[model samples]
Target: MKTLTKEMQAAITPDMALDLLKQGNARFVNNLKINRNLLQQANETSDGQHPFAVILSCIDSRTSAELIFDQGLGDIFSVRVAGNIINEDILGSMEFGCKVAGSKIIVVLGHTKCGAIKGACDHVEMGNLTALLTKIRPAVDEELTITENRNSSNPEFVEKVSEINVKRTVRSIVERSPILRDMIKAGEIQIVGGIHDITTGVVQFHEVESL
Candidate 1:
């Protein structure tokens, strides 16, 4: 497949962008990946990149956005952080990706069995990571179920909190960036969240409205 052009990016509606990702993931799951010459793709994208989507995902080894989405070089802008939490710098990157760089979608991707989510669930306080994990604390606090087993060791509670974290990150992006919000309001761009099942290689997008 060819790298997306500016017109192609601009032509994608919110629904279409979501559909593209869904289809890409389906291809990934079925191992029907598109054949591409990676070296040629690298050369094609050398002069510039026109990524179609901006993915805010975790630092997890198992959840690389491009690999899971079946995208090649210059296909997506990946903004990774522990817990996939949003902050000022991440918001700036998203702004640049959508408003300046012509990305059509922003996906806040969290995954099951994420170490960052586990850290947040367990309330692990390290030196700098303490502050980073603090961003996900609200999601942990918002989780009402599994009161007795609130730690990361509880798989059910951890998954629930992970989902909440993805939704919260989606909201935070819109709330923190007026540029992104206007883009969404004008239907120029879209933001959504999803959870990746590491063991199964499945990514389940949350309801669009919930984003």
Candidate 2:
């Protein structure tokens, strides 16, 4: 696989960028990863990078965007945070990645069996992590389907909150950032959400044309 160049990044459309990720994930699942020289790609992208997309995913070790997407260096920008929640700093980073960096799409990626989500589900509080989990409270509240057992031990409840959190993050990005919102409205960029299955390594994407 070749490293992404400025010209290649420019030529890629939002849908095309998404398709590239889908294809990459398929390769990951089938263990048919593209072979590329890391040193060569690093040397080629030393001067500058023109990544096609910016992915906001959880800090889970199993849900690495680059590996799961089968992307080479400079192919995509990966932003990681626990629970994949949206905040001012994260919005600014996404703005920089898309508005200033010429990325075509933004993805809010969540995953199954996420520790952060579990923490939020159980209201785990530990020093700074308490503040971080506070951001995920809305998602936990939004998941009203499972009122009986809304704690972390209940796997179904945790999974439901996880999905809601990704979707909420996807919407919160556009609602929070005017630069990204205008870009999305003008078709310059696209936003979507996905849930990564740790066991299967399959990312089930939820499409949101505008939100």
Query: Which candidate number has the best TM-score?
Result: 2
- Put down candidate 2 lDDT per residue, 1-211, tens digits, no spaces: 8788888889999999999999999999999999999999999999999999999999999999999999989888899999998889888889999998999999999999999999999999899999999999999999988879889989999999999999888888878888999999999999999999999999899975574
TM-scores, all models, native as reference: 0.96, 0.98
lDDT of each: 0.89, 0.92
Model 1 bad stretches (over 4 Å): 209-211
Deviation (Å) of 87 in candidate 2: 1.5
How would you encode candidate 1's per-residue C-alpha lDDT over 92-208 as one tens digit per residue? 999999989988889999999989889988889999999999999999999997779899879999999999999999988888888999988888887889998988889999876
Candidate 2 residues lying further than 4 Å off, grouped into runs, are none
Q: Model 2 clash tally?
A: 0
* Worst window of 10 by summed lDDT in candidate 1: 202-211
Pairs with backbone N, CA or C atoms under 3 Å apart (clashes), candidate 2: none
